[model samples]
Target: MPILTGDQELEQRNRLPTLMEVLGRRTLAPVDLFSFYIYMRDQQRSVDYLDFWLDVSQHMSLCRHYVRELRRSMLVETPDMEKATSKRSSALLENFGESLGEAESHPSSNEKRSSEQRLSAFLRHQHKDSSGTNQSPAHSMTSQHSNMNFSRPSHEPKPSPHSEGPTRPSFMGSDQPQTDSNSPGHTVARQDIKASAEKILYTFILPGSEREIVLPQSMLNRIIHSIEEEGRDDPEVFDDAKDYVFQAMERDAFPGFLQAKALGNLVPLSVLIRLIIGLASLMAGFWGGFFMILRSIPRHTRCWLILPFTIGCYFLVSYQYKIDVVAAYLGFSEYTFMSWARIREPFVRKLLLTRAMMASLMFVAAAVALSVLFIFVPGADF
Candidate 1:
């Protein structure tokens, strides 16, 4: 686990590695990932970013849904359009709705403080409380998650998997026909997309809304101009905002979550198991080396372990391919970056599972060869 500090600058650096690190990652079900974090983030009063992100991201799905509809209109040959879209629609939309379901409720109560205001207040308090000038947000006495004690609302239902903003529409309009419908049936047309985009602008981009987000003035102006000028319904309208919001989550919100969950220290069981398997394969390679060594010197006994393991490994590692290809192709893959968050559980699991299985086979070969070596060499205690 990384030592979180009072220094905000150092904390930022600590989070940078989250993007590249792909080793033992815990893949949370989309529901769990969003629900848990949103709840946790809510404790800090910073749930707006996630809420905004979640809402904006739904547009991407709406875009895809539109594409499938367009494809059907064109009579293109395709399969399984609704098969994958339903769960995702719920995962994305429901969460946004659930979290912001209380949109009518004003934040006048003490518990409903602004996340940025609360965070800044905490920082100011910390500055006065301690002589130390620099503090990472995670370990800062005033940071949001530190005060929550990691409690969550158990009875409350979790919303769908979304980032912080309203959902955006996608540009691609080439999806298949949905013969059978499912839950969260978000069949968006151009007008619906335009309306949703306008709502996002009003809530997040426009200045007067209660949930107004902090975006660069120029970028904000650009988005406002694009949609308002032509009354355009392009899914790409929210593209810049999406990138900005995703980065904000990566920089600010994610670390607080890691700190709150203490996920840095806890490895998911599946990932750990796969890691062991991958290492086992490496160990098996050593046995293969032993086999080569024993073969060179005329081995006296035909040990069952050495020959079998060696033969098994010969066909194992050479032609290996990603095992999760089918899952990915079928859209089990993570849709948005923020949905996966910093740990990227699903992505890492796919990598480890594929590599580990192949490595495990090779591992046995190496182990057997090593055993044979010890058996043949007298008094060679390892």
Candidate 2:
């Protein structure tokens, strides 16, 4: 391969259309094109990138121009597409008519043909003067062949007119009294139209990544129009657009954090800080409780030394087990404490609680034993 010169490199860099040109030409969906511009912008960290966006800001109003061009193009192409579809449908109907004509040699086939003709007339009546009506090709064909039934020849035995009771009305023919909106054929046709209209066709580049998002045209249009209207009063509409793009980009992060928290993979710094503060507060409260208990006894008594020593041992045991007195004092339930502790197993949690409670009891027993020993020992002075 040959090496590229400076001019050639510059040409390669400018090969892609500018944001203004892309917006004006209607080559890509407005949102996708803009998002791609943002992705490219985030990658290049230089004054040149700033200048590129500044150039884009000058043509922010070009979005309206592109919308107008799209409308015009649709107006031009819709007639051709409709004409083609109509021709195809008419051809299919002609083929069906020829097939029915071939079967006319049979007497039963003539009755079937007459019934089909009546059904076709009814469909034509329903569709007449309604240019915007869109029905599936299958539904249209089925409607054209509705209410068909074969009859026996006159030579065969027939049921007496008195034996036949009044018949229920048929929904498949024009002679039917009322239209059934909930009929299976109508429902299927409506569903087909809805599914086709909602099908996604456009893919947009997401900000801060090379990934693209696919969505229906209507949804994309609504999102783009909403962003445009929101930024209408702002002097820098491009900045507003950037804000919307980045907001969409960050939408997944929140759900991802929640999933991580559920899986016990996430530990927020704020939570850790809160826990540290709570632990310190609990230590201070324990010291205060010890002081209050000691004040109830004489300060000069030999039991005074035992209180401090026992309290120290209790603090050491509680700290080792990571138990906070404030949690129990605040009337926290087991589930609440489990969440704070981030422990999942009930057995391990119960074991830790047991150890903590035993430590407190041991401290109390030590204080009582020391006092009894002092009282019994001869000349055990304060």
Candidate 3:
């Protein structure tokens, strides 16, 4: 029924949220968050930004994974933020008594106990406990329920129903209730706890704007600073800021970011072409120098004599990433700073030409040296 994809839309359009909306989801699956952007932006042509998305997903995954680990290590009564949350929860509860005055008639003891039980169950669900066994909260609750059987005989130590009035609700010194494992309320509370955990992780891992795509460095710095400012009120703000910064800078992290495929490693096809041109120049120097030296013209012709040498030298000097094989062989002391000539931004191709010249000189020199050494060596049979 949609106008966008039309007939094609029905097959692909499953009523998914927009990219920005997915990115802002309260509970985001790491893969879903990243794929949405790639699908929206037409990834094939936007190869450069692929690294950016990879970084975002990796950080999100890591932050989510680490937070789950942190939560798994904590008990409801002993959370990582024990000192802070304890004080805050205590302070807030002091004012809760008045709010409960009206609800007291509805069996407040049972209600308070229920809330505590839910909290305990939430924690148990997150962590398997110290027993090194896989005991579920429902299993434990079932066991406790079985132990509370009120069907004992009259002679058994059961107090008379008339003697025992309703139990007084004591929020301060009582256990919380445990809802029926199959009840919707229990499922909803469990989901709420999970949502809260994720939010805490999100705040801890990405305190900033947490953009779906990392922007330019200049923009990122501004966002980071802003997030840091906002994090002042939230103790977990640092973690969030750290997560974003880590992801933004992660491309340069090498092995850790091996999958990111950043451009820094991929010299542009144009740059590669330039490098090839430079390599070819090395040949020009070698051949030019050899041909000039081969012509038996008088040495007094400085201009003619120096032409090949100069040509070869130019190629030698033009080589990039320190490509001066001639200099290395001759042990010649021409200023090595010339080697950096290839590395300058908007690279100079002169080095390529120079490298060829150097190659020529070496060929000519080796040829002449071999001819003389063979003719002059003191042996005998010549």
Candidate 4:
């Protein structure tokens, strides 16, 4: 792959709006979407498909890296890399380790973070670097690898797709050939790759495994055979399964993710609609009820005005759903705005959810009270 200059990469990553735009740009990754699903899943843990899809993506990344390193090692003549590889493999396979797709590119967990802020910082730095005439390809790649999706410490070097040949697995960018394929490092990277693939199989692919992803029996057997019998760890081996999960997620989960992350901005519109409708009904009910009682119209005819009032109450109360809390606590102008999905902390999300729940309880209580007033004493016109 050709090295991307800073401008080319900036153009590549500037806000993908559509599914095709995201897929075509190779900028909006599955992790971005899956991470959103995981965020929303904290409210309801039923979103297993997104989590499963993420594992599939991670495994494919590992396999792709494995195959690349394997081919690179094939041309080299090196001494046994067994001892070095053993430690690396153990580390790589440790407890379904972090996703390898762009670990170097993500921010550390402890920071007060927002995905939008990170993306903005990433774009700003790129613009500044691209403005300079003397930028090198290695420097551009390091900037991308270290801080494209998220910011990193400035002192760290750049990283790139092909640059992390297992042994050099970080953004400490270097221009040297990935390995003296003839050097003893040959087997270490490939060995790590193999170990990771096996770990993924045991953790997420095999039947009755700890966290197995749902797949057809034949597909599972084929994958098991590929990893075990044939020892073929490459993107090609998992194409069917990857396509399977990709299609499932695209058809079902993507719609919901898109709705929550994109269309959620319409929440304020819903609130406005409810507020307008509620005010109209509330006015009509109060004016009509008073007008009837003053004119001494039959209680039967005027009591029906309570119906619209009750509906108004229900909508107005339900619409409150703690918008003030969202704005005050989360500093969002709207509850479900895309930036809201950027909140990485679970406790913060739970706090917002709790406040919203309290408002829902108020709506329910108001609904029940109105229902009782109408049912038990419809003729009691006050």
Candidate 5:
């Protein structure tokens, strides 16, 4: 493949809208349609990201099927269109004319021809349903409203029977090579493979504009070796290469530290505030209920104590779970590892963590006071 120059790239970009216009023209040939699909897929890869891989894959599959259908229909219909106008004096009239007699004389062949023609017509007009409701392609290329169906206008002048069907246009072939029927879309498939490979490389490289990572020399060497053996014939080598990448990424210690750092930095102020509010609410609810049960039940009827005890236990378990989750997210070893005495914090780490702890304790105290006022003080219904 020739390297695309800066001017060539710009020209390709500008030609996109026109190429789309050409594809939308009802005069598109099979080869033209196929080329359009290939270009569309390549363009899609450039715009689509890793998160949308599944959607892109599904769309690619649909495009392949649509192109296949277009090729089949063109093969059957274009030749039939040619034969239809053979007896006509004007070759230009041939493009639109149908040979009813030839279709009739073929016996079982008539049914087959008719069926093929009907299929072709359906493929041509499939964008519009019988009720004239416009439908998107099998996979959406854009917003449904943005995707327009291109159909030949009934009043458009057609070629005479003596004339040939429209010759395939030239502009479609600038960067695209001529496609042969037996090729089975090698270019687009190869493009997808390359896109996937690049994505894999990026996954290991780690994407961040702020800094370039210096991976371990051993790991880097392993990655290079893996790339070398990517498509080797030996199954063991391929598996080993895959394993090497997996192991490099999966190495627990380094990633664990990086994750610790990321978790520390990424935890938002709102999340810490929310955690404090939640814990405070829990403590208030639990303690208030505990004291209430204690006052209401008789000392003789000790079984009533279990209700408040159960409530306290439930609160404790739930709060512990919540704390563990938050602590993990905030880069603490565990909930119990909150204080510097238990677990050391980096120089500036306490700024956020300390605030979170203070807020939590205040909430806890407020909840306890509220519970005391409600349970012990008389006429405190509100």
Candidate 6:
């Protein structure tokens, strides 16, 4: 075995090895190579440093064996490193033509400790080179695993039985032998991907406030289904609902209860209350108009009064005040009323006022006419 001279070690410093070279020189299977890459990558070490280690190991042949043994030992002894079994460790040592006993007996405690310190320093140097700041190597390692992709290369064919080595565990503990889709890790990963893809964000603008709501794809699908179901029964309702949703999206405004109804969700209590109030108002107006007409009509002219009173009552009950009241009760603010008041053109205002006054006078004339008929046709019936 060749030994690395002092000058050689210095020359190879701060360089990392390529994945191919590491696999070739280390005689590692693809899976093992992947694990090694993950471990180093998590440590935030550069490819240059990896190359340096590989070069050092090649020159000092004993260095390669020792490093491999050390990694296996770390896996076995360091509880936090990875879940390593005695069988796996033995397999690794056997593959490297070394025994655990021999490895332990040969390297003194000082030498082992020194090697670990050197590796630690190498990692720290790599971290500083990349980030320009001192950061905890262990923390960096722990943080990166969640986001790392362990996808297998498409070009690399599966190993044949003769070429296959012992099944090695992933350093991240996620690579299990089972290809079953039911595996917990795989299921979680699938769910994560689905969740990330399904995330839908909608911005909602209300009076003096803004908010964002995130709906999963499943919820959106349900909403779509609801719309489709509703459409089958009532096309007009479906069209209105679709228009409402599009308008909401365009304006970034979702009025309470109305939006829920548009989405075919349950009508909110507030909306139900408004609907009830509107129905009651219509009923009350109808009854009030009927009684007003009845009181205005004279019993003597009762036969001729029905038609005029019916027409008059219809107009009276459909008055602008009923509309204004309903609008105000349903959250149309003073600002909305002010918008209507802003029509300040003299001609237009006068025309609108004239039209309103004429309607009112017509109603009063119908009542007065009835009274006059009662006076003229006295004793026709009270």
Best by lDDT: 4
**Candidate 3 lDDT score at position 321:** 23
TM-score of candidate 5 on Cα atoms, chains taken together: 0.23
Candidate 3: Cα lDDT at 86: 45
- Per TM-score, the best of the predicted structures is 4
Clash pairs (backbone) in predicted model 6: 15-48, 15-49, 15-52, 16-47, 16-48, 16-49, 16-50, 16-51, 17-50, 17-51
Please tell me which model should have the higher TM-score, number 1 or number 2.
Answer: 1
Report lDDT (CA) for all predictions: 0.42, 0.33, 0.32, 0.44, 0.33, 0.32
Tell me each candidate's RMSD, in Å, in order: 22.0, 26.7, 25.0, 17.2, 24.8, 29.9
Order by TM-score, highest first: 4, 1, 5, 3, 2, 6
**4 or 6: which has the higher TM-score?**
4
Candidate 2 per-residue lDDT over residues 1-382, each given as its tens digit? 5545534533454222333333222222111232223222222111122222322232222222222222333345446666565564444344434444444333234654453443333233323423435332332223221221212323212222322222111111121122123433332232222221121111122222222243345554554453333212111323433344444433533233222222221123323544555455445545544454444434345444555445554444444333443343332222212333233223323433454466557656655664455433434132
- TM-score of each predicted structure versus truth: 0.36, 0.21, 0.22, 0.41, 0.23, 0.18
Candidate 3: residue 293 lDDT (0-100): 51
Worst 10 residues of 4 by lDDT: 141-150
Which is the winner by TM-score between candidate 3 and candidate 5?
Answer: 5
Q: Estimate, for each residue in 1-382, the C-alpha lDDT of model 6 and write its tens digit.
A: 4555534533443233233333333212211233333323322222222322222222222223233434544445556434343344434434433333343343433553344334333333333343533222121222211221333444222332322231222222222211222322322222221111121111111112122223344544443453333211111212332334434332332222112211111112333444455455435544544454556644444454435443443344224222222222232211111222122222222333444455456556755664344334434234
lDDT of 3 by residue, 181-251 (tens): 34323321222223333333342233352223334565545444533442221112223343454444333
Indicate whether candidate 2 or candidate 3 has the larger lDDT: 2
| Clashes in predicted model 4 | 2
For all candidates, the clash counts are: 45, 0, 28, 2, 16, 10
